[model samples]
Target: MKTFTKLAFLGIFAATGIIIAGATAAQDAPAKLGDLEVTGAFTKAMLPGQPVGGGYFTIKNNGKSDDMLVSVSSPVAGTVEMHEMAMQGEVMKMRKLDTGIAIPAGKTVELTPGGLHLMFLKVKEPFKQGGKVPVTLSFEKAGKVDITLPVEAAGPGGHEHK
Candidate 1:
């Protein structure tokens, strides 16, 4: 009787763990906002003493009306600005989008590296791998939605950290 009870308890514990893991995965899935699907939201890990960080994500508009991403803010940085990088006359120039990025109806907008991205200025602490950065995205029509961006491992930039 004791052996049977112990086995039953272990099985229940394992099933509970699996259920909790499934729930956590669902929570990390794409976040939605008024017919908009926000996916692949992540930021690269930053080295210690690094003053800035970059964030990338993809937004899909499923509605018939267009929307605008007005602003992005995070507690990790003093200000987060939307920026664009383009090649102009053999020089890669970067500019801030004061008006914000537009999400056309029935279209997808990707904020990727070397193109459109979020610039985290005045960062209080460097982003570490396996950590999450909480941010609030404000849209003109969809209102505001809070999302968390997972920090991934940074690629080699010719620098080594102890």
Candidate 2:
């Protein structure tokens, strides 16, 4: 009788362990960023009929020496370009650069509004609130890094959480 009880208890414990593990595996997994360390990411709220959208993220250089971001691509937009808003003559103009942005060694470069950003133009679908867009950023030395930017409603600023 004791042997029978022990066998049944072992079977029950094994089944329960498997059930717990299966439930845990169903949750969303952590996002993977290749080569570079990504932090302090946010995207401005997009509106319908808006010609362009912007994506912002902080890229940290972990390796020795500096690196340059060559390009960025995404399926959400027709084209992704590196742009800078600067004063040329008397008016501020947004100019697209042929080369990519640069990041210094042991320092973080930020891509934010009115600064270095990914210009997502000709969006296929209307960017709705609470949606996520996947973008792949390629660097000269760091290779390629994948990031997802969350779309939010129109607000004063990005909602950041530590």
Candidate 3:
């Protein structure tokens, strides 16, 4: 009776270990860009024939040195440029910046609307809401990281986190 009980307990423990391992594997199944951490990601609604779309996200520098975000690429758009918005004279101007935005060491840089954002111009098709867009964000030091941008409804915010 003692031998049978020990064998049953070991079997149960082994099964639990396998279950936990499976869960962890599923969480990391997506394609990764680099070691940079991405948070608070969101994007505006997409409309047919719209000239551009904007994406906002927060990046955190976990390393000791600072890094620059050089560019972005997306399959849904023909061109993805790092852009900044400002008021030039009486007009609100959006300018494409060839150089990427810099993030300080141990600091979080937010790319929000009306600020530094990724401009998705000349979209190939309408980005359907509640869909997924694969975006590759390239950085100077972190190299490139691929992330899935989840499309949301026409709203004021996307996915936000503290």
Candidate 4:
């Protein structure tokens, strides 16, 4: 009878610990802002002597009206700009989109390599892999959203290590 009581006590203690841990993890999960959802945000690890870095993410708009991503800013970079890459004839060109990228109503927009992305110019320090960088994104309708960009390997198609 004593052994049975002790076993029951241990089971209750283990169940309580799991419940607490699950609750804490749920609190850390990402949250949506009304009709906007931002996910899979990350930046590439900086290369040696490279002053520029790229940030990529996915933005989903669930509202009835369209939204535009106007600007992006980061303390680690001197300046951040929204840019688009395209091929014109035989030449490859990249240009800044001052007007911002549009996120259509009920559609998702992706900022990835070789396409629409955020350019971090004049970085204060090289971004290291397995690190997190904070950035603020300004949307025409969504207002300003703060997110952490996880740093991954030094490649055009790199996944967040964290």
Candidate 5:
């Protein structure tokens, strides 16, 4: 009877630990605002003395009307602007999007490398891996959504980077 009681207590403790861990993970999951869902947001680690950085994310619009990402702002940078990289003839060029990017209804728009991304101009400090950068995204219809872009190593991949 004593051995059985000890085993039961240990099992209960293990189960509780698992439940707590799951709850914590769920709290850190991606956020959904109105009909828009933002996920997989991250930024790459910056090089030494680099004044610029890029941010990428995936935004899903589930509403009936289309929405536009108007602007992005962060306190870590002096200026944040929406930029697009394109190949013009033999040279690659980067240009700012004055009108912002449009997100059609029921579609997911990805802001990635070598494409549409946020430019962090005059970064106050270097973005380190395994850190979170607070950014506010302004949408035409969704208004404003605050999200934390996880900082990862300079690479092309999703989060969970080591």
Candidate 6:
């Protein structure tokens, strides 16, 4: 009877640990506001002395009307500006998007690298891996939604290679 009790106790402890780990992983899950869903929000780690940073994400609109991502703000930066990168006569040019990005109804808009993205101006501290950046997203019709963007490695690719 004593041996059986110890085995049961160990099993219960292991199950509890698994449950806690799952909850932590879900912290970065997608966020929904009305008919819109935001996912894959993250930023790359920045080197020291870097004055700017970039943020990326994907927005899905499911409503009958269009929505516009008017502005974005972050706690770690003095200001966040919407921007886009394009080719200007064989030279890559980055431009500020004063009008913001549009998310049409029943369509998906992706703010990614080398395209539409957020520019973190005058960063207080360089972003480091494993840090979470808090941001507020304002929509023309959907109002505002607060989300956290996880900081990842500076290198590209979803996962780091050995």
Which lDDT values do the candidates have, in the order given? 0.73, 0.61, 0.63, 0.69, 0.71, 0.73
User: Over the stretch 1-162, how does candidate 5's per-residue lDDT look in tens digits?
Assistant: 012243453453243221101110111556688899988776767756666777877789998999999988999999899987655544455678989999999999877665678888888898886777899999998899898877765433333321
lDDT value for model 6: 0.73
* Residue-wise C-alpha lDDT for candidate 2, range 1-162, written one tens digit per residue: 012243453353243221101110111333334446775544544554566676767787776778898998989899999876544444445567678888888787767554566778887875665777788888897678777777644444333222
**Candidate 3 residues 1-162, lDDT tens each?**
012243443453243221101110111243433546886565655655556666767787877788899889998999998877554444445567888899888798877655577878788876666666678888898788877666655443323322
How would you encode candidate 1's per-residue C-alpha lDDT over 3-65 as one tens digit per residue?
Answer: 224345335324322110111111267889998999877777776656678887789999999
Could you tell me every candidate's TM-score relative to the true structure? 0.78, 0.71, 0.70, 0.76, 0.76, 0.79
lDDT of 6 by residue, 1-162 (tens): 012243453353243221101111212678888988998787777766666777877899999999999999988899999987654444455678888899999999877765678889988898887888899999999989988888766554453211
- Name the weakest run of 10 consecutive residues (lDDT summed) in model 4: 18-27
lDDT of 2 at 14: 41
Pick by lDDT: 2 or 6, better one: 6
Q: What CA RMSD would you report for each candidate?
A: 17.7, 21.2, 19.7, 18.5, 17.3, 16.9
Off by over 4 Å in 2: 1-35, 87-90, 158-162
Ranking by lDDT: 1, 6, 5, 4, 3, 2
Residue 49 in model 1: shift from native, Å? 2.5
Q: How accurate is candidate 1 locally (lDDT)?
A: 0.73
Identify the runs in model 3 with alpha carbons over 4 angstroms from their true place: 1-35, 87-91, 157-162
Worst 10 residues of 6 by lDDT: 17-26
Q: Per TM-score, what order, best first?
A: 6, 1, 5, 4, 2, 3
Clashes of each: 0, 0, 4, 0, 0, 0
Clashing pairs in 1: none
